[model samples]
Target: MSAPANDRLFRRWTSRLLLSAILLGVCHPLAAAERPNLVFILTDNHGAWTLGCYGNPDIRTPQIDRLAAEGIRFTRALSSNPVCSPTRATFLTGLLPSQHGVHSFLGGERPSAQMGPDAYCTIREFASLPKILKQAGYVCGLSGKWHLGANLTPQEGFTSWITMPHGATTEFYDAQVIENGAVRKEPKYLTDLWTEHGVRFIEENRDRPFFLYLAYNGPYALGRLLLNPARNRHAEYYADKELLSFPRDTMHPWQFHNKDFLNNPTSIRRVAAEISGVDDGVGEILQVLQRLGLDEKTLVVFAGDQGWMGGQNGLWGMGDHTRPIGAHELMMQIPLIFRHTGRIAAGQTSDLLVSNYDFLPTVLSHLGLSDQRPPQSPGRDFSPVLRGETTPWENVAFYEMENTRAIRTDGWKYVARHPEGPCEVYDMQADPQERFNQFGQPAVTDKQRELAAQLDAFFARYADPQYDLWKDGRSKAGRLGGAAGPAAAPPQRP
Candidate 1:
């Protein structure tokens, strides 16, 4: 059988993105040429591979796809980590998880390091994107998941924080939400509630340069789908679709709770429909920007906090057994779309090897707050790349979560767990699905050794003596079967 016409059409159009320029003629805001308002749309556990623009004909993401058509999209955008909280930290701080230290999902508990006054989650430590932007005459607001630490009060960077008290909730209807310092029960859908708050923030701050860190609890929180009235509202949106029709018949792209991926993956259609709710929110937000004529003066960024694995690489979800830790592609490759009319060229795509680590530095540089960044931050300013400017860029990016460590270059990807165990090496040029692990193959022995050494050296700098996954025996294999807790097993996901 031949491939779909849309895929072929997408390929032809993809070829022209880098070679094309989309010129827009809109009246610039009074403060537009200076500091444009920024709306950062961050989603939880969204996979980059699921979008229609990314060649997934099954999933419907027209709102996000349109952003790609109107602005630059990245072919090689990755999450800093495969989990949630850590990746969010990187986005705010421009530093990797190892440096900033929000390692796993903050589940109603606090890390020992983040205890008491001047904690990292309380908006201390390094200056986050919101802090710097706020200092530079931008009113910053966050209206969604703020899963960095224990206390969920409004932090320093944000002038307004309408957030969820618990990191995550199974609450679909009658959910409790915190606004500024007050808490209330909202009977509306979670996505709509967040969108409502975001739209309000945008409307209130449209007259000036503002920063809205709009995060959503859409498709990622999967367990509550049936309980969620949203399921009834959206299930029929994809009623005609079947799992086999999707790019991979493996699993759902997003799961609400970590355990949602434990069983066979949920229906892809239902998952896509869940995302459609998020799309609806995005559409509403975009409409507001256009209606207020703030579209030209605002920079809209849609990104996933981190990617999730749903039976990719035979790993059922995000935990143990075949899932292991950090061996698959979906967990790291998340969606990233940037749109700013009159500034960034439209319909542009590039394989510039960007990661969540690059988000803050790039935002800083674009907002003219690069000087505020700490000297030791690990991020690079890639605003030029987004503007379609040619600049020397990274070819390899590093990743780590708990006991796992990985490095991916243009040609290959290497993943390994620390303190002795199995390792994976994939020839990315040939097998992007990562079906084969060639780490032990004699043909790639030299390459494996080179990557192994580089991985070790790269992590060596961030290695903490008190808790080093490699040296302190933190890996599941290092613990040698049961009793290592979540870190020791495949059943409980981190």
Candidate 2:
């Protein structure tokens, strides 16, 4: 055993170890990256059919349509609730309003603290999407609307936020904005300003994995059109504007109240214009990512907080579910698109029913992180579907508002109103418009009963006893108060 022979053997073993480490580094970079950059773009009051990719003839959403062209689009997507705060909360925590307890708009119905016990506060106990991602070593940033609560200083795991305060009045230019808790005046339009902040966040965090929640409050109420009392001022100011318009055939009853000046062609065009402004902002954000060469590596998602009635059932805004003007497909169906170059299938459409609650899980799965199961969350990760893998997602998607709850399967939808109201059942395959309510009809009575049973079981399984109006009296108290209710009360300072 010579000393030189022993030394040569040791050197060879060391060289092999070094080579193995380099190979592992090159092959599993995502392990070191450990977090994927997540950009979740959420729009307020933007309906599913407003984009060109969604088969709308008039809305020129070139930026969003482009993303769809390069990503997978879910044609039958929906929101947990058809409102802002509750829906956003559901998306973040993967819990329905009944569980999260932010069932209505913030400051529009109940005091923030009374909404639930501190342990059940939507933003408190629930692990938010940004919060979870941050724990996994991702920088978290939020831009645009922060309707969950005015105090958006990352209490639930965000690092930076540039947001509009609760119930901030919408203006095209010179709107007030809050940047990281400081009240600031921004000269640009609301949507554009949010886009600027989002782009800046991306630029600054391009070197690190990050999560950016860009929640836009455009094309929603209090916009340029709704800001005018007469509603005539909108058309008068933007007259002859070549705004994109959906096909008249696609326009529903809930879009306008009547054939008055409020529902005139010009007013409709103005609504379209406001949406165009949001679309332009979307383009700016996308362009910024491309310019920074982060487009391919980043996972970008575009979705609306919820669908708007517009005028489907002679309704202008979100209607009371108890006496719904329209609860048809148009009012609930929203667009969900995911774009990650070479990861998600391009130019594809998935009929797999998806809800906003699925967003956090799917994003987490795509980033190669282990899924976190929240207590009693009903959402399932759709990463398999997004990856073009066949998934047997036979579970029905559930939606609720006030005293009404609806359940939709692949072929049928059943809606039931509590406190004694006529239930409705529709064969979505045949009556996609939901013009006919076949509940109690001799032909579909059995099917309706079956669906009702399923809905009942779903409620029993997922509905929190604390928030369930059918079981608890608190829900009734909150709804009856309306704008002056406990649910609408502002949050008390901690």
Candidate 3:
């Protein structure tokens, strides 16, 4: 054999042997060993109430429940904005909708006209979680939905990108996927494909400290999609079981878009099936981590971009499904679980009122990178809670969706609309379901004023001037939808 050919053959064999050694725990880089890896499992439009760990009586989510049991499950984690793109942007940038300017879920199955011919990543200008981690010498990979626009390319600091063609998912099977600049229709289940890609990324990057954004676009029970029966592997399991956890109530007057699917058995089963599918993927991921000996050295965080309501208050979807933009508890709270064995305590649940805006700061703080947190972020560091420390944390969280703004305190919640006449105040302790609006009652007048003032002050301190909708600031995506109320409409930009 020629000398060049012999050298190439020898190099290939050497590379294979080294990879085998690394996988077998025989060798590991010093830098990679010191820095704990990150596995951020982000789900789409899922509510905390759907999981067993969060007290759901009907749905089957044993894997997620095990994760919660083995780590810290936050009981009151919330999203700043109860939509896809806005809350997702908040998670990545630690900025609220007013700061990031993605006021709503980005355009559907196609590129948004607002972004022009050249695709634009909505949060490109901000210091994203992936970007920050990448700068800290960690290789980052994103598998699944990247709904923040420019889904065709790797955005921010992600090097390995496998994402949906666009933000929305019309069908999980035969879905269009963009894998490393190549777009193709994936025949397999989208959820399974996302899991497969995540596993591949982990195995490929085992030698280095990596950040895996294992995003799953599943259990997205909304619109016409919910009208059909689920076809995943778990469909048979949920076929006959009555998912009573999904309330069967009289149609809420505010519900317009998803009224048809309210209390529909097929839709309920579909959602349950999807949730179990995601749970299966979670189980596989955990198994892989254990097999690779990275379970203890990695931090696995599971969270939802926003919350969803399964026929709660007779409402079937998120806040946007309502005319005045609902900020109901079921549409705000999400499951936030963190499992980092040895470093974090197990079998614990925290009641600290936290938001997705606090995610980036807390994760960075947990990894000893709090100094890299964005200056404009209002996110607080709750890493101490993760370490099983009894730290005094404030019991409050804020929410915004275009013209609507809300403040959730320990026992009170006040939702205010821009230049509004129909504001809402609910004594959360007295009425957790938010059925009564005590905004104008003479007895609750002082309490209403106090909560409203606090909400106003929070937005005033955190909201960026250029994107504050209460002050006629524009949304980066486009105009608002389902804004029937007078104050819900954005002011005319002349």
- How do the predictions measure up, each by TM-score? 0.82, 0.82, 0.91
How do the candidates rank by lDDT, highest first?
Answer: 3, 2, 1
Candidate No. with top TM-score: 3
Compared with the true structure, model 2 gives a TM-score of 0.82
Off by over 4 Å in 2: 1-34, 110-121, 150-152, 221-224, 227-238, 241-262, 473-494
Better of 2 and 3 by TM-score: 3
Q: Pick the candidate with the highest lDDT.
A: 3
Q: Over the stretch 1-494, how does candidate 1's per-residue lDDT look in tens digits? A: 01243245434433342122111113333332368889999987677767777877766778988888989888888876776677888888777656655556665233322224533453254557876666556788888888775344667568788887666557556888876566788888888888999999999988888999998876663454533233536767567655443334444332324434343335455567777788888988999999999988898999988776544543433422233455467778888888999989999998888888888888777766565564446677889987889888868888877666788888998887644445788999999988777878899988888887777777676543333444443211112121123333331111
Off by over 4 Å in 1: 1-33, 108-123, 224-232, 245-267, 319-323, 462-468, 471-494
lDDT of each: 0.68, 0.69, 0.84
What is the RMSD of candidate 2? 11.6
Tens-digit per-residue lDDT, 1-494, candidate 3: 22344346435544553454355344444533478999999999999999999999888899999999999999999898888889989999899998888898887424472234767888776778887777666899999988888787888889999998677778789989998687888999999999999999999998788999999999788767887888988888898988899989999998867777898998899999999999999999999999999988899999998999988889988988888788998899999999999998899989999999999999998876776677778999899999989777898999998877888999998887765436888999989999998878899988887887788788789876777777666676755664424435532211
The CA root-mean-square deviation of candidate 3, after full C-alpha superposition on the true structure, stands at: 9.6
Clash count for candidate 1 is 5
> Candidate 2, 234: how far from true, in Å?
13
Residue pairs clashing in model 1 are: 220-255, 220-256, 221-256, 222-256, 320-490
